[model samples]
Target chain A: MTMRSPLSRVRGLGSAHSGTEHFLTQRMTAIANVPLVLFFVYLLVTLAGRSHAAVSATLSNSTTAIFLLAAILSVVIHMRIGMQIIIEDYVHHDGLKMSLMMANTFFSIAIGLCAGFAILKLNFGL
Target chain B: MAEIRTRNPRPLSPHLQVYRLTMTMAMSILHRITGAALYFGTILFVWWLFAAATSRGFEALNSFFDTWFGQLMLFGYSWALIHHMLGGIRHLVWDTGRGLGPAEREFSAWATMVGSISLTVMVWILGLTLRG
Candidate 1:
């Protein structure tokens, strides 16, 4: 009942087997981002013109911390996947593309960790 | 695998330069550009978080963000974020197997551009007014 080519089936491959997962996760993150990003903008507006202590205090709230962390995680993953697609399409060189893909993943992870750690530290008043 | 070589230069597919510009095409490119911009812009978010966490150098960072140049950069970043966001929504709509008609596609493109700018302006206005 499969539509895949016989050769593809024999090779146990099907058009970049992970494409659907990538596409779905991208969309899922996009949906999650809609509300989370709105909340983020609201946080920014609330923080505007405030003192450092005031800003930190606002971020220290558990709800605020949770939302911020979630947004950061989703945004980073979504960004990495998006960039990977662009790199795949435009970078034809196998070596260069693989390097860039690795860099992109590492960069996203680094950003996520740094941002998440900062949020947690602030939340704990450390 | 046997080594293979082409006697002639490989035929390359037509790229951006080969096509005439259109609104949808431009917006599609801009969506990717703005998405990339947001990737870089996340550094600003991280800086803010780090400043908040350390409770040191926060004022200096705040002052820098308050300056005209910093404000301009923030404005650009906000616009890019908003634009990419609306572009994402447009993409989601397309994913649902809807809005693929040529007219709907063009309308969505225009809406994404205008809506992002308007939303950014509204947020900025609210921020300024609330500060007063």
Candidate 2:
């Protein structure tokens, strides 16, 4: 077997590879976002002009609740993946890039969690 | 006699004209632009949500979103959101190292643009249909 270049093997290790990983994740998330987004659009269109109670009632439906949760989760993950790539590419400060990536992950998670909880609470009337 | 000679070698890799542009490339660029737009656009969503949650009757929110300018903003935001999502998928396929050739790349690009626009138009049509 022909030997690979040292750079070829090492190029993707650690920080360098993280960018590629992020890119892959971005694409993965995009594929995931497709169905989730379509469902979300349908959900939103249905929710248009709905009363608060009616909206809550719809969310309370197990199917609706699940759909909403899935949509939010996929979207938040997708956003995090996209932003991570942007930061890795543009941010030169090593410390700042790491810090911002961590912060972005946390924020996206929090938003997803809160949004999920809100939907659940509304649906369950708890 | 003193003479100076200089050999300007041809430029390095990635000559723009040599490689035909692909749909994947176009989509890749759109993905970035849409992502950036969505990043900023989230602020609008935050503002609208805050207005609805904190203020009375949703009038403040309604007034803002119901205005011509508000509709335009919303339209732009929706387009960005949809476009970015489609472009992101195109990127994902590229990342897998499967769709880099000329034909597939162009196909994905046109698909992203056409898909995004079609979805936008469909949604708008649905909105109009619902209203009537």
Candidate 3:
């Protein structure tokens, strides 16, 4: 049986099991982002500013659309954990640290959705 | 609560100020710094995508990026992104229990620094050529 404690409110005295989850997810996203980020560079550098129809049509391609969306998701998550680790390391003030952590969460999600929404809009035109 | 303001000053790990600056240490800090830079850069990226998706104001956005200032920022951002990526790769290599030696760390530090810059320069060169 897993040794996780049954007590719900264990005060300030226990290991936070979620740290491993955070660490592993950070690495996982980092691994995924390498290729995704490369594709993203290619997408913007080559195809971004062509004609409107060309851009839209490119996005509509299944492979391009999927990879772009995957890149968006992977990158946003990577950046979030990356920033959170930074804040945890350098920002020692309690309130400020908590606020920045929350802000990082909100910022990552907002941008992820914004990027994903944009890609979907381009792909679907709806 | 962080309890950072407790009356008794707490003992701490010796920090950057104490250590002689080494290639590995510099790369370690640069990794964090570039990571922070890329956070802001991601905002610019998301904005670019949103603009392109909406099909409105896209030209103005792209044109801004075409300007000198935007070009400088993009140059900085791309370099930061690439450097961070290489740094992460080095970390991954170290995570595998290889390349953890002091000399190996220095080698990887040099590799990350040079590799990121070279890649950024090459990519931008090709990108600008394609644009032309």
Top-lDDT structure, candidate number? 1
Least lDDT summed over 10 consecutive residues: which range in candidate 1 chain A? A8-17
lDDT of 2 by residue, B1-132 (tens): 112335975564665477777656567767788886776554554443333333345455566656888767766767777887777666666667998888887787898899898888788779668757
How well is each residue in A20-124 modelled by candidate 2, as lDDT tens digits? Answer: 776566566667778877776665555544454454566668887787687677777777877877886678677888899999888788777766666655555
| TM-score values for chain B across all models | 0.90, 0.73, 0.87
Better of 2 and 3 by TM-score: 3
Best by TM-score: 1
Top of the candidates by DockQ? 1
lDDT of predicted model 3: 0.82
How far off is residue B38 in model 3, in Å?
Answer: 1.2
- Which residue pairs of candidate 2 clash? A27-B92, B23-B105, B23-B106
Kindly provide the TM-score of model 3 when superposed on the true structure, using C-alpha atoms: 0.87
Q: What would the per-residue lDDT of candidate 1 be over residues A57-80, giving only the tens digit for each residue?
A: 889999999999999989998999
**Tens digit of per-residue lDDT, candidate 3, span A1-126:** 757674643545354556788888888999998898788776766663466667667777889989988988888888898898899889987789999999999999998888888888887878
**Model 1: lDDT to the true structure:** 0.88
Better of 1 and 3 by DockQ: 1
* Candidates' C-alpha lDDT: 0.88, 0.68, 0.82
Better of 2 and 3 by lDDT: 3
Tens digit per residue, CA lDDT, model 1, B6-102? 8987877789998999989989999999998889889888988898899778998888888998788878887887899899999988888999999
Q: Which ten residues in a row have the lowest lDDT in candidate 3 chain A?
A: A8-17
